[model samples]
Target: MSALLEADALHLRFGAVRALDDVAVSIWPGEVVAIVGESGSGKSTLLRVLSGQVAPDAGGVRYAGAEVHALGEAQRRRLMCTDWGYVHQNARDGLRMGVSAGGNIGERLMAAGTRHYGAIRDAAAEWMVKVELDPARMDDRPGMFSGGMQQRLQIARCLVTQPKLVFMDEPTGGLDVSVQARLLDLLRRLVGELGLAAFFLTHDIAAARLLAHRILVMRHGRVVEEGLADRVLDDPRHPYTQLLVSSVLAA
Candidate 1:
């Protein structure tokens, strides 16, 4: 598989805090890669940078052999809006509370210059079904939905554009255990069926194991270990990775 996204020697700082330090990783087409670490380890920062939401102080981000920052604003917006989908850690950030479900999904199409209401409504309904959201609630506001339903709506909205690359920040975070399992299963199936490349950030070791084709374990803003999921999870080389795996197994 070709490299869909690449980050090299990434460095970022927020005054006295170093958010990322010389971080590097590459995501392949049609694969799911997870970046896992404890809080403040720069996992979320890396996702933000990769998705072009934040610029790094130094280093490079390349998508399909083209520099992300070097692209013009219009071009970046086009690519990120159509070819990429971003799911933030906070589900609320991923949704439009005031709009109906159909409106939320239609927003992506609107950004892509589609104006026909019929087309937008049909596309929205199709995608909502794809994400397992009921078409019956298409007119309901996000606030009217349950937490799990809101997350589902958010996923439906992001994916309506059929993005090639998706950046998911703790996608199953803040959900009940049952909801998390169901969502994880949905993600796994969608990635496999659509051949979508994903870069997901998470703290759940089992979530990583279940969904990621590869794992990048981070500590203190740097990736301490990276490898195939089974190898990394079953036989972690780094001390921190080992500890994480052991703790997950113990729990």
Candidate 2:
């Protein structure tokens, strides 16, 4: 498959810290690529650059064969609204606490030019069911929900627009283990059913293994190893990657 998103020779720096260095990666349609490493390893930085949230000091990002950075701010925003979704590590960051769950999902539909209230409401309810949330709770505010519920609602909101690609940052990071497992299962199912491509960042090897088809291990702003998820996690080649895999196994 051709690449839906590509980052070439990416480099970024914050003062003396190099957040990304010559990072090159690609994501194809219906694929999930995970960037995994310890904190400060530049995994998040890479995600930001790839998603066009941050411009690299030296490099380029392309989406669907167009230079992403070359687009005007309004164009970029419109592209993000229509073709891409971003799920932040914190549900609060992705969700509007004051808005009803259905309202949150419907807002994206409206942004995408849906004007009929009934259709928007129906779509939001349908997405709620898909994410395992009760459609009856669609009127409740996100602040009234649990952390896991908020995250699920966030996912529903993002997917309701049928975005071709989604960017997620440590999606399960703050949840309880059992909740995380359920969310992961739901996410896997949604990704498969929708045929959506995803670029996810995580420090958890198990999360990467469960959700990612391909894994890129980063350290010191550089990718130390990358391969199929099973290969990279089971028999990591780089010492850093080996240590990451072993630590997860030992836990």
Candidate 3:
């Protein structure tokens, strides 16, 4: 299987702090790779770099076999025009609060250079349905919805473009326990059904086990351990991985 996304020898730094230190990972088509790390472990930074939000200090990022770092700003923007969606750790970061739900999703189509109003609206409605949201809520602003619903809307908006790859940062954060579980279930189903490849970042080991086929465990800005979820979580080789697993089991 070809890698849908690849990062090789990636390194990034902010002032004196190194965020990503020679880290590497890859995702193939139709695979879900969970990035598990404590805060400041560079998981979010990796996603930003992959999405072209943060340029790496050194290393290579190749998407669909194209050299991402080599592209001009306009060329990269055009390449990513509608081929990617990002759900930030905070739903608000991924949404425009003033816009109606339908408008939020429609905005992506617009950015992709789509101009037909009817087509954009229809696409937004279809995405809302896929995320299990009611079409009637299309006119509602995200401020009117529950936290869980807002998160779902963000997901719907990003996945609407039928992007081959989606990046999610701590997606279930800030929701109540039950709401988190429900959203996770919905996300798992949507990814499976749509055959979308996801790079899901989470600090929660249990969530990683639940949602990922492969797990990459990070500590101090490096992938300390990586393997199939069952192997890494069930038989952790790194101390940090063991600690993470133990904490989840204890909780």
Which segments of model 2 are wrong by more than 4 Å? Answer: none
The TM-score leader among the candidates is 2
TM-score of the candidate numbered 3? 0.95
lDDT of 2 by residue, 22-100 (tens): 9999999999999999999999989888888899999999999889989999989998889999999999999998999
Instruction: List where candidate 3 sits over 4 angstroms from the true fold.
Output: none
Please give the range of 10 consecutive residues that has the lowest summed lDDT in model 2.
242-251
Could you tell me which 10 consecutive residues in candidate 1 have the lowest summed lDDT?
242-251
Across residues 1-251, which tens digit of lDDT does each residue of candidate 3 receive? 79998998999999898899999989999899999988898888988888788899999899987888887899777666577778887899999999999999999888888899999999999888888789899999999988889999999888877888889999999899899998899988988998988999998777887889999998877899999989998999999999888887555
Arranged by TM-score with the best first, the candidates are 2, 1, 3
Cα lDDT of all candidates, in order?
0.90, 0.92, 0.89
Q: In lDDT terms, how accurate is model 2?
A: 0.92
Candidate order, lDDT descending: 2, 1, 3
Q: Candidate 2 clashing pairs? A: none
TM-score of each: 0.96, 0.98, 0.95
| lDDT value, residue 188 of candidate 3 | 88
Per-residue lDDT for 3-93 in model 1, tens only?
Answer: 8888899999988888999999998889899999999999988888887778999999999888998888889999977899988767799
Choose 1 or 2, whichever is better by lDDT: 2
